[model samples]
Target: MYKSTLALAVAVGVLAQQANAAGFVEDSKLSLSSRTMYFDNDNRDVKRDARGRNGDNRESGQGFKLDYISGFTEGVVGFGIDAQALWGIHLDGGKGHHPDNSSFIPSDTDGSAVSQWGRFGANAKARFSKTEAHFGSALAPNLPILVSNDGRLLPQTFEGGTIQSKEIDSLTLNAGQFTHAMGRASSNRTGLSVAGGTQDSNKFQFAGGDWKVSKDLTLQYYYSNLEDFYKQHFLGLVHVLPIADDQSFKTDLRYFDSSSDGKNGEAGYQFSNNGGYAKNTGEIDNKTWSAMFTYTLGGHAFLLGHQQIGDDGGFVWLNQGSVVDDNGRNEGAGGASFYLFTDSMINQFARAGENTTFGQYSYDFARLGVPGLKTSISYLRGDDIRNKSGDGSYNEWERDARIDYVIQEGTFKGLGTSLRHGVYRGSGEAGADMDQTRLIFNYTYSFM
Candidate 1:
């Protein structure tokens, strides 16, 4: 905590030195965003916890985020800073409804929900030509190798230094190294690690880039290494074809190759293989590929995709599930997200020897005279999922639907509302059957 505070102080001192610069204060922006959410999860298989209660969770919470972004100082080498403050208030849900392993809310010492929590972060940045560098604890990266998770009240953050360069025409390069992560539901930061690994790894390095070859085609490649955990490489291609004035077809292909690194598979550095079969238990050795195609006409979109997991092992990504506090309590870093269409609302249909097929349909109500409304529904089914026992395979499926609307005109013109629900079922070693729902209200006020 002191380190973060010192970093922020240094950044502020630097910014104060250039407070009178032409573009620094004139182009700064400040905004506050508010979100109220209600979440419900029902486990159909109903397993008893230590307290002998069913595995069902329901909660409501309110979150507020304040952001300040400053424009770069006027110079050949510009300097700036970005800061954020986040606060979460638990509105409802008692011990009976709060599971011990829940990642939606922080837990108290007595295994109950905490009344409230909050955190603050800042980023010190510099820009030279088309290249930019940022170092801070508020980094939320959206890359093919690492995606910051914001599925809950607050967003997950990383403590890292990153650089991006777009000096070359039609190309962008990115590289970064992160040491710690702040979970969405907690105020504390923990070192990085993967699922089923009890020990933490302080180093995660990645480098990647995107190259736009033409008006409608792009290619991407990235490499990531988690110290003592695993190393992964990613390749992606995207293309779009116009069919008519209001119609187009898009194609996206992604592939990943992962292997064990350092002491992976050692005592405290084991991988879970996503709770499925691993050719060698606790080892990372896998190859996965996916393809997605979409057709759009008017206000309607149809999407279809297929994904295959290699028989060697399951997919892998940066996860902090095993990072705990000194008292052995969870630090709320259990949940993470990867870059894949299989990353659905309920389950990530990724496991060894699994094949998944998914589809989605969406519509923009603007075509029917309602400019602020839209809806989408999707379904995914996975089969041939290798069981841990290696005797046979299992199958699972999930269906999700959501609707969103934003007030277009009025005092609450920018207010938005969303409702989403998902149902998941599976057999064999797959996870428990469950149904989940979420309702959210969001609004942002700018104080530029």
Candidate 2:
């Protein structure tokens, strides 16, 4: 990644005059965004700290982001650049509230919340026809195999080179090799790894494509592998049928197959199977599939879905650890997302032998003359969770509610507010009952 970026920078010098004279500055874009968030989570069965205190983990903070994107230069091989700057400030998490799970704020060496933190990244690009190549330290990719998480105050970023091509209409191709990742928390960047691994892997390769077979049908296939950890394959299908002018039916199907690779089962590099059943103790071996259907009419939409985790183990995905090292004390580097709708506000029921049934109902108040108001409620139940003991089983469930509103056409236009709450409960220790809530305010301004 660094070498590629250097090469692009050298190219910029040779063509500096033509590049700037071209469409670069004329087509450039600048944007600034701000978000204020309040988060609260109560652990039903909390464990005491060294100070013998256990309470709801509550925190509030604000985030600011700035982005600049320059358009490609004129001629066959055009050049451009993209950059991001992020800043986070701690508002109100007191001394006792500091924990590894509090990823929204930076921490002092002693684990106390820092006053402020920030990071900046830039990536250079070259484009030709319908193909573009990006090389840099900040890559946000949204693909069937990988999804850059933006669920927190800051977004997770990767360092690598990616090529996207659409030379053939209706089909898009993507290939990339990412070596390092910047977690949502720390300003530093670290190598990639799976959850529970103490070491980091520098190599992650992926290739995929999306093929639109028809106006209403599309197909996707992707392959991703984290060196010495795991390799995975994904397949997805989506189809939509127009029932009426204001009504439609949608179907989505997804599947994943994963297995251990290289040093996955060897001592220091062993994988944990993540509190789920595994035919082999310290390895990744699992298959997961899900199907979902939705029907929408006027202001209402209903979604129903089911998912099954193969008896071997839970599902898997990339989880790069923290950048500021504390001898590996902090785990779950930062926020992450998967392709599954089941990757909800709280729990992700990817445990082995687990079968989940879920449903959601949403309403858009636009039909009632409230164009920017929306509300939704969802429920998920997962049973037949195979515990590590293999003979034992557990079940868990979660309920989530959300409401969002945006100021449509007023002085506050473009301002958005969102509220989300979730409750989760389970039968065994595998599940920890808890309640979580988040309130967010967002606003953005674009500079052309």
Candidate 3:
């Protein structure tokens, strides 16, 4: 993986340097960050019986990241390059914590720990007025149908080409077709598939646009079709309403409808009744919608949100997965883990048929004394779960609290510290009750 990434990076750099050297400009910037993380999973009985659940082990680790961006030249057509370098050292990840799990890192034949792994990718890009194109291996490109998965330590990157444009004012357009995916680990590129099904298609395509109608309102529409998988459409609206002087409310509404396409075309994948043997008959139609409102007053803010998924299928999207890094979470990998509908205290509250509702209150203590500190508490409850088989009903609840501080001035103005905790409990198909905590300290430095 390392050698391949290096060769690709060099090729991109060489090509960019030679592209119409007369009519272009050369500018470069770099940013780097370091993070340490501690992880622990103590789910006793639930560790074994949980369907599709991976292993749970206690571990701690540290990682470093470097990001670089180069500016294009001036002309009708310009070219540039972007690069990211990642390195991680396992401070404490051992066989006990992850226990037979190869998701975080690749496992050897005898099942033992390796020192560490490094990842890097570069993109060659060209721009023509309001249009631009990028080709390379990199982060999960943001697309509706085949969103990247970020469920583990690092994010998934893909090797492909993408194009975007904004020729019309107040209107933005984007489209990308990917041919290969570099899983979060191994640095190896693999053929793209839908949820690990037998059907394999190397190409994933998407197109979308967003438009702002007024100062405070905007509308969005996009279409995504993954070969042999599913086709999706997304519509979104965002608006802000002034209720008072310093108190205003912002609303974010999003809806998505998806169905199978191509070889896996609509009504393509099917199976017999009576819990017959499952087959790669493909999937059926699925729809999901969510709305959230937030209000701010004085030094405090309040938020409320609700989300629902229609029956007949599970929620789907291009997931980029999650990571344990302190820089923050990346969602472009391929992991499906998410806290409930509440704050960041992800427990499983999005069970079938259940309507999940959440409320949160946040306070900025800096207004009183400190200048870079804040805290928040939130709760989410889901009831009326209809279960996967549409039989029984259940209820679940979660409470989460987070405190974060960032240096407000001087040399450490951007340094951050955070503490997070959560408790979750539920009845019926909501799964087992559990508690988890996370502590993070982060800092970033930019170079230009």
Candidate 4:
């Protein structure tokens, strides 16, 4: 299916390209980016222990990628192609750096770190009358229902086709279907699934739109389904109030409803609700909601948020089996992300009956004569997380800090660096307490 999809995509683009050859090669762009990352997680006493989790898991790696984009041919229906090549290198990861759990670096067959790994992909695109369609194997989608994970050395990629249309002003529509995913930690492509189950689902479909009611108000709704795992619907609202020329207030709201699908309740496909409450045992059933308010003025921004998960079950999203390890070949149990304010550096507080309160303060140092520098601090506390005892619950909290800087001038104008640290503590079923730190370096250059 993956090969066939790419073949068809190329055929369509080539046929369309023959109609209009103007500006096709003259407007092409090529770019290269390099990223160096260091990750450390120290797990403290808590509860359950998975197969590859350890008291301390640390690794360092580097990634280099090259991208090429061809301009659309001039015609009623323009055509283009985007290609990507990624390479990952292991810098430092000692023994016990198992491939099953290490996200930033790929492990070898003997549970050791591989010296290097790489993958390649391409995307074919066509444009017509203010609308475009993209088909092929390299897609990163940012929608209310699902968000691609890019927290590690490399970003995840999906194999499928997506379309976006803007037939009417102030309104945009999107739809797509993905059949496979290549995890950040693994080089091979695999089917999709969720936590607690190793079964792979071959289909993931989604459609949504954002409507701008007015200049300051917008509404969004998206629906997503991962075959045999679950189906989810998302709703969002955003409004901004201009208090003055330099200050403003913003309100953002999000909600999700999820339910079971085919094979969800089968023996090997049954879910455990992620160690949280569920209306029906070993099934997917959940509702989640969150609201956030942010105030920005000059160089400072303050944010406050609250989130809650229904007692029926924990919120669910995509996970390509990155958790399971069969000797070392990738079978896809990887991580993923959803649209939520609490998906911080260390935790995602989406368990059943969990109520979380969070806040953040950020500042740009440019106001202090330090350009291209910024810092932020955030904290989250979650409680009343449903436990097996039904009436009883557990509690957890996390604190995070981050600093980032990008060279704005001189020989390294685009060089960027970032540092992040997180401290997490939890009681009850939330699992082990841990401390995590990440350091990153990035630089990108473009040529035409």
Q: Can you give the TM-score per candidate against the true fold?
A: 0.98, 0.96, 0.82, 0.94
lDDT of 4: 0.83
What's the lDDT of the predicted structure labeled candidate 3?
0.64
**Could you tell me the TM-score of candidate 2?**
0.96
Local distance difference test, per candidate?
0.91, 0.84, 0.64, 0.83
Per residue, candidate 1 scores C-alpha lDDT tens digits across 23-84 of 88899999999999998999999778778768687999999999999999999999999999
lDDT, residue 369, model 4: 96
Instruction: Sort the candidates on lDDT, descending order.
Output: 1, 2, 4, 3
C-alpha RMSD (angstroms) for model 2: 1.8
Error of 2 at 47 (Å): 2.0
Q: Which tens-of-lDDT digit does each residue in 1-448 have in candidate 2?
A: 5576687677556546665566888989999999999888888888878865465567888989899888888888888888899898889995576665566676676666777888888788889999999988779989878899888787889888899999999999999999988877668788887766667788989999999999999999999999998999999999999999999999999999999988887765656666777788778998999999999999999999999989987788887743345644342256677888789998998888889999999999999999999999999999998888784468999999999999999799999999999999989756788999999999999988
Tens-place lDDT digits, model 4, residues 202-243: 789999999999999999999999899899999999999999
By TM-score, the better pick of 1 and 4 is: 1
User: Residue 385's C-alpha lDDT in candidate 2?
Assistant: 89
lDDT of 1 at 29: 97
lDDT of 3 at 258: 70
Q: List the residue pairs that clash in candidate 4.
A: 278-312, 320-332, 320-333, 320-334, 321-332, 321-333, 322-332, 322-333, 322-334, 323-333
lDDT of 3 at 159: 77
Worst 10 residues of 3 by lDDT: 270-279
Most accurate candidate by TM-score: 1
